[model samples]
Target: MGAIYTLGNAAANRLSLLLLTLISAEVLDVDSFGVFSLFLMSVASIASISAFGGAATINSVVSKFYMRSKDLASSVLTMSMLMSVFVSLFLSALFSPAIYDIANASGAYEFVFIYFLLFILSLLMAVFSSLEGAVYALKMAKGLLAFSLLGLLLSVASSYFLGAIYGVYGAIASIFIHRLYIALSAGRLAIGKTGLHVSVGSVKRNKEFALMAFRRLSFPIAAASVLAAPAVTLALYILGKREGVASVAEFSIVYQCFVVAIFPAGAIGQYLIAKSKGVLSEAVNVRVQAAKYLFVYGVVAFLGFWVAAIIASHYFHGKYEISISSFLLMGGAASIYCINCSYSSFWSSLGYAWPIFYSQIFMAGSILLCSLTLGETSLEIGFLLGSVSQIGVNIVLLRLTVHEKVAL
Candidate 1:
């Protein structure tokens, strides 16, 4: 039942973003849409860095202490938020120059400040994500779904209206507003509803514990996230350089659809992580159940993609027509990627971060290598190859790590 609500929350979240993508595509020119896509990709990467795996760590900690100590959970949340502030400032300073250069190169220099604003907003979104993890740990998925639905409605309405009037800036402002709403809502639910008290004094006292939590648990996952989150951003950067911004727009559209298709796998993976409780046996069960869900969902999602492709191509009047071959290749990649995620989540639950790190290394390396070698004409091939490489690494690592203890 918790899983069901989590899935619904995932669906609503993805649907909201998809609708915004379509709206942006409809309102903005192809090149502008490409820039918007780049902004979003940057946000994802920045959010991961700013989060520093605090979201997942909070989930694990809060779950472990939920029955034991609410004060500890509250303290962890406060610590994570403090970490977010420092990380976000450091990241903004570190990446701002590079972002400006990218904007100048892409002929979107005027929008650079908006891009920076969005980058800061990503950190706020990260904080929201941590709160959401706490909510999940508390089995408050129903509340999450309700808040997400409300946020979805607000975001869509705001994005559409603002996008039509102010172009990319307005669209981004909508995202800013939406993130604020979600962060506030999640904080309320995690702290207010749960009756968890967080304070500066609590954070001060737990400073050592916070450092230990980050060192022992969050650091490795953060490393893995730092690698994984940049995959799409790097791909887009390469594609924009190799092809043109318009091609980047087209690729972003397909990738957004791909993301929507794979939402179920991600939702399930996160739910498993929240529920697995660091037990290898339970993690194995999670992996198996995830496989079953993915197998059924993958088929339906691919078929849905095909129909969507046809309709989207017609609606856009060939402005964004996706080829059948591209659909098949990307669908295959999405499926393989789902498998990797399911397995990776198993390791994540067990607190074995090296496997996740290795998987990201293989996956990101394959994608970047293929993108550099294959050129724009075969970009989808890069996704396919990357997914294949990731699954291969995941299987080998899983077997080597757990072979003696678990029967395959």
Candidate 2:
């Protein structure tokens, strides 16, 4: 039942995102949509980083201590929330000049005033998002699904109307409302279940544990955020600068849709990590089963993405042009990335996260190289090359590390 709820929540969340993207693309002008996409990508990247790798680190720590000590779990949550807020504010202030530059150039200076507010809202959203790690770690799948569904409905409805009437600002405002709801819902659940005491006092008490947690998990947490958020945003920003906002718009649409294709793999990976917390043989069997399913799903999903791309092009009334070849390549790349996610979850589960961190560095370097050489045309190509490189390295590491650990 937990597995069922987990997958269902993932599906609902992905579908909601898909709908939001579709609606935004449909309602906003191409240039406006491009800016909106840029805003979302940038905020997401920064928020992920600010979350202090909460998705991985918080989840792992919460899971470890959830059963043994509720006080410790609450302490972890308290410390994470404090750090999330601090990082968000610091980053927001740091990026203020750039935000000003963009607003001034775009003649949207009035809206620029809202940037700081948006940053706070986005940060709160991210902190709440990090709390989901506790939910998943605790196997509160039903509660997760319920909150995700409610958030999705709120996001879709508000985004649709606000986007149609208010444009980008309205769209962002709507997103803020959605995030606020999730944060409240997830917050209530976490506090209710674990009795979280998120005071400065709690943080002071847990400072030692927080330091230990950061020392242990900082590398992978930072690496994962760098790869997932900022790296992708940087790629898209470069593409937008060199090729045009239209190119950014096209690729953003493709990437978002393609992500849905690989979400099942992500879901399975999380499940495996959560469930395979026992005997060595059992963990190996879990990985084997996960691999088989991912292989089959990836093949089918790659084909399905091609078909979906065609339909999407028409559905949007040919607003943005997407090459079938590029679309398929990106889809294929997304599959490999999903496979890497599985290995990452596996490594994190076993306290061997540094290998995943190292692989991301290698992957980032490869993508940066491609961007430098291939220029604007390499966005989709980078996706493919980077994924292949990361997956290859992770597989070798997984084999060597798992065997060594098992032998020991």
Candidate 3:
């Protein structure tokens, strides 16, 4: 039941994003759409930094400790949110110059302010993401689904109307509004239901323990996330530099399909993480089952996407041309990524973060190397190679770590 609700919420969230992407593609010119895609990718990467694995850590901690001590869990949540504010602001400031250069290079100097706003919003979203993780840990997936659906409806409506009126800026503004609405709603549900309170005093009091938890449990995952999340951003950056923004726009469409394929497995992985109860042996079978399901789903999703691409190509008539071969490559990448998510989540549940970290390193390294060399012709192929490297590392690490009795 929890898994079902989680899957639904994931579906709604991804659908909203996809709709926004499609709307943006339609409303904006190819260059503008490419810039928009770059902004979105940059936010994803920066949000991972702002989160610093805090969401995963909070989910694991809240699941383990909320049953034992609500006060401790509340403290962790409070401290995590407070930490997110500082991290987000700091990273955004630190990266501003680079962001400007990228904007200028991409012929989006006028939209730099919007990019900055989104960057900050992405960090703030990290805070609420941690809260959402807590909500999941508390087994409130049904509520999450409701929130996701509401957010999706509102986001799509606003993005479509505003995007039509105001082009890329309107689309970006709609994203900001949508994220803010979801964040506030999630925060209310999490705090009101859990009776969690956060005050400055509580944050100060819990600082040591919270930092300790973050260092021990969250740092490696954070490292891994930071490494892994930016692969797409790096690819887009390379594309913008080498092949220009039009290629970025085209690749972003294919990437959205890849995201659609992976979201279900990611949702299942989140459910596994929340429900694993910090037990490796207990989760092994569940993880295997999840991998099996993902394998089947991946095959279907890939074929379905291939068919859809064919139809879309015919209908759009080169207005937004996506190479069928590129779509197939991304489909393959998404398949491997789905399988990897299950194993990565299993490792995370047992507090074994290094394996995930190493895998991300390989994944990022592969993407970086490939993007620099092969991205001129096809961004999808670079991503596909990276996905292959990621899964290979994940499989090796999973086999080695499955027998270990890791303490959480």
Task: Spell out the clash pairs found in candidate 1.
Answer: none
Error of 3 at 371 (Å): 1.2
Of the two candidates 1 and 2, the one with more favorable TM-score, higher being better, is 1
2 versus 3: better lDDT goes to: 3
How does residue 174 of candidate 3 score in lDDT? 85
Predicted structure 1: clash tally:
0
TM-score, per-candidate, Cα-based: 0.92, 0.91, 0.92
In model 2, where do residues sit more than 4 Å from their true spots?
94-114, 278-282, 375-377, 404-408
lDDT of 3 at 326: 80
Q: Could you tell which candidate, 1 or 2, scores higher by lDDT?
A: 1
lDDT per residue, candidate 1, 1-408, as tens digits? Answer: 988998898788778777778888888877778778887777767787778777677787787777887777777788777777777766665555544555554545544564468557878878987887888888887988898899899888988899899998787787787778878888888888686666777777777776766665678777877776677677778788777777777877777778887876777777888888888888888788887777778778777768776777787775765576666777778877776778767876876767777777876777777777885446678778878888888888878988866544
Rank by lDDT, highest first: 3, 1, 2
- Cα lDDT tens digits, model 2, 1-408, are 876887787777777767787788888988778777777667766787788766566677777777787677677777777777787777666545443443334545544555676477768767876677677777876887898898788889998999999998887777778778877777777667565556677557777887777666655666666665667766766676677777777777887877677776777666666677634665666766776667777787788788877887688666788777777878888777776666666666665578777787766766566766785447778778878988888778776776655421
Counted clashes in each candidate structure: 0, 0, 0
